[model samples]
Target: MTTTPASPDSTMEAIGQAVIEGRAGDIATARQKLLDIWSTTGATGDPLHRCSLAHYMADLYEDPAQALAWDIRALDAADSLTDQRVQEHHTALQVAGFYPSLHLNLADNYRRLGSFEAATEHINAAHEHAPNLPQDAYGALLRTAIEQVSEAITQRNTAKRASAPGHPA
Candidate 1:
């Protein structure tokens, strides 16, 4: 019997298991594990892997700035990604589906940082990209979050969103 090596994405997903499971006690360890992989993958690694790692890494940070940095990294990676790469890793995924959530996260982070103008820009981008989202639960969630983040920016509220990941929902 032979065992095939785990693919990079499988390894990446394994490292993020703690965050995905919401294992409250293992978050710090998960962060370090993901960082280890990030160090290996570097900025020029596979875009899908970088995007997934950075996106998951963002959720582990309670600090808005820290999360914003990771989110920005994720978006940058997404910029280099193509639908073909996404499908190779995840057949259900399309590149267009990635933008709304990415922009929404940026908007939320900018709003939290009190950068209302930047937040507004991102939120509008999210809204504009929303039609690309599939009419599914994930899409619905992002749409709702986009609206919520947009409203928070309008109100000039810097408070963390209740629905935000790692926000002690």
Candidate 2:
């Protein structure tokens, strides 16, 4: 019997496998393999996969801003999918609700880029989302830890300003 043609899901699965195995080159190659098929079919999976690949690649590119763009694209692709998938992807992801992982990543990016306000915003969002996390003894320790880090950074800067040579105490 003749073998059936591979589907988009299979292509995505391959890409995921490559990604999981820490084979960035293979991941990109697998993604490109599906790109041609998507281009021919004009399949919606195109953007979804592209967004995913781009997001991963962005991190590897050492550019947080680019990563954010890819994340936005992923969100847009999820929104544009069929009603059922839209609900499953978009609704479940909760654009309005805080997403700890995304927020944490964004927060770190903002911090590195010296955008303290934006970093704090994401940190706050993360805390809001994970209000029940456990810390050493107190509840929601992760949230507390994040807050402490953000606050420490801010406070250190403030103290630096006050202690600057010839500056008033």
**TM-score against truth, every candidate:** 0.90, 0.48
Model 2 spans with C-alpha error above 4 angstroms: 1-8, 21-54, 74-98, 131-169
lDDT of 1 at 51: 91
- Model 1 stretches with alpha carbons more than 4 Å out: 1-8, 15-18, 21-25
lDDT of 2 by residue, 1-169 (tens): 1223233365456545645543434445544543454465343555545544444443432355655554444445534545333233333323322244446545655665667787788767766766534332433434554665466446533221221111132
- lDDT (C-alpha, whole model) for all candidates: 0.84, 0.47
Error of 1 at 166 (Å): 1.7
C-alpha RMSD in Å of predicted model 2 compared with the true structure: 11.6
lDDT of 2: 0.47
lDDT top scorer: 1
Q: Cα lDDT for residue 121, model 2?
A: 82
> What lDDT score goes with residue 164 in model 1?
89
